[model samples]
Target: MASEILAQLQAQKLLIVNPRRKNGLIIYKKYYAEFAGPGAIVGGQFDCDAIAVLPVGKISLIVPQTPEERRQAYKMRRQWVKLTKQITDNPIPAERAQVILNQFEHWFDAQTVENLPDEAFALLVGVLPQTITKVRNNGLF
Candidate 1:
């Protein structure tokens, strides 16, 4: 399997920077190698995790993205955003919560989130107040 992957990589003039030391590779191939797929000899088929045949040029990779890798990354990102929202919105009084939400939205619009330091994030999390219950005084209540 290693040899086959190596051969395909070499054929496509693709570079595998920093090859993995263990747990074999996840190869991404074109859906129809007959046309857009590699025009090279292929070895016998074998399965380890999942088998995928994507359209040619569908993936450009320094390292192929495994199913688990993609899922874990998305999950972590979702959790991060959820934590940030919970810290900023759920606990603070309505006025203060809106202020924080606006600030966060501004940070996002200004493209500053990427540059924010760990200290800034930690401060935000640390200062979040306990959630305040809102009781409606109107007839709807």
Candidate 2:
């Protein structure tokens, strides 16, 4: 689902930042081990699933200074609904829209500091040419 969204975003020329890596064992030990047990260890990584489509003649920049600065940068980019709406409004079919929405929802669901599954991170990096092909065939976008 996320791969589908990424493909659509890229097609619309949106900029996507790489997601953050997760230290799976470290995170599990530090957080969930108390309830799930050591045997329930899981791991994953994440990228900022946020997409930013710069306004015409405008450029988007990412400057990673301190960790706090990086967080702020991501937050600002994530909250830019203008960019998202532009991409979403690109004449895509309803099915395509739903796929993108699902992916975005999944990313939103993983916004917490812990307990995010590895699959979420995997989705962060996955690509979906199939979605693009479908859109192209349907002449939706």
Candidate 3:
């Protein structure tokens, strides 16, 4: 029975959420044990800058599988791509941009625009696409 459970776990594929950018949700196809370590934050750390890992079941709960959700997801992914381009255009190094992306991911999960730290909010607002401004300003994201 234990081995059967372990086998099931090994076959599981988790969804990783990088809330700040496009292509934020990725499938984690590797063994779950690979992420069992000291630094493991939500299933185990991957090469992604800042990602939240969860089972597909859990992700489905948080992100409904609906037309509206699909629209929002696609929009966020496009914004993420734009954000990456902006980062490339600026003097900020790729390493630093990754850090910034991670910060945004945390902010997305933890705080609303209204409650977010001013500096962080300002930095994002300055670089983010205009399409995102409405949601950001309304404190909805």
Candidate 4:
């Protein structure tokens, strides 16, 4: 049987993510990836191209959002962007990859990134997935 990624839901409208309960990923332009970890929100700002669940643990769904919940979601997205800007802005590919792993390590095991295909990272930074492997393997892999 084909293995399906869990919770590949389309955002017909805004979809807010609650990271304490659900970890999610939003894919943009078919390649660039945004991870929604604890407190992050995906479709809140705009409709997402695609969103899928990360198997972090038993999952929970987003409830109807309150004002405070929306605020938290927006705040997390800002933090998420701030975190990855380091990767996207840097000219060095290997250095960009290393910075992303360093950021991920602060929240979760850097190895948990294996949950997503290496190609995602490749596309995100415009490098070969092999580059991600080479950089990731050097430490905390």
Best by TM-score: 4
Indicate the residue-level lDDT of 12 in model 4: 43
- Candidate 1, superposed: residue stretches over 4 Å from native: 1-64, 91-141
Q: How accurate locally is residue 44 in candidate 4, as Cα lDDT from 0 to 100?
A: 33
In candidate 3, the residue pairs with backbone N, CA or C atoms under 3 Å apart (3 or more residues apart, or in different chains) clash, namely 22-77
Where does candidate 1 clash, by residue pair?
A: 31-54, 33-37
Q: How far is candidate 3 from the true structure (C-alpha RMSD, Å)?
A: 13.2
TM-score of each: 0.23, 0.24, 0.29, 0.70
User: Judged by lDDT, which candidate is best?
Assistant: 4
* Candidate 2: tens digits of C-alpha lDDT, residues 1-141: 334433443443222232242111111121111111111111112222224211111112222436565555446444433334444454544444345434444444324322333333222223244553443346344
Off by over 4 Å in 4: 1-9, 21-28, 51-59, 139-141
Tens digits of per-residue lDDT for model 4 on 19-119?
A: 76535453444555565556755553343355443433233446436878877777887787676765778887888777665655555554566565666
Candidate 2 TM-score versus the reference: 0.24
Query: Which is the better candidate, 1 or 2, if ranked by lDDT?
Result: 1
lDDT tens readout by residue for model 3, 1-141: 323323333444222243433212222233211111111112122323222222211122123346565455445445554654454465533333344445455534433323433333223323333323434444333
Full-model lDDT, candidate 3? 0.33
> Which ranges in model 2 have alpha carbons more than 4 Å from their true place?
1-63, 80-94, 97-131
Top-down lDDT ranking: 4, 3, 1, 2
Deviation (Å) of 54 in candidate 4: 4.9
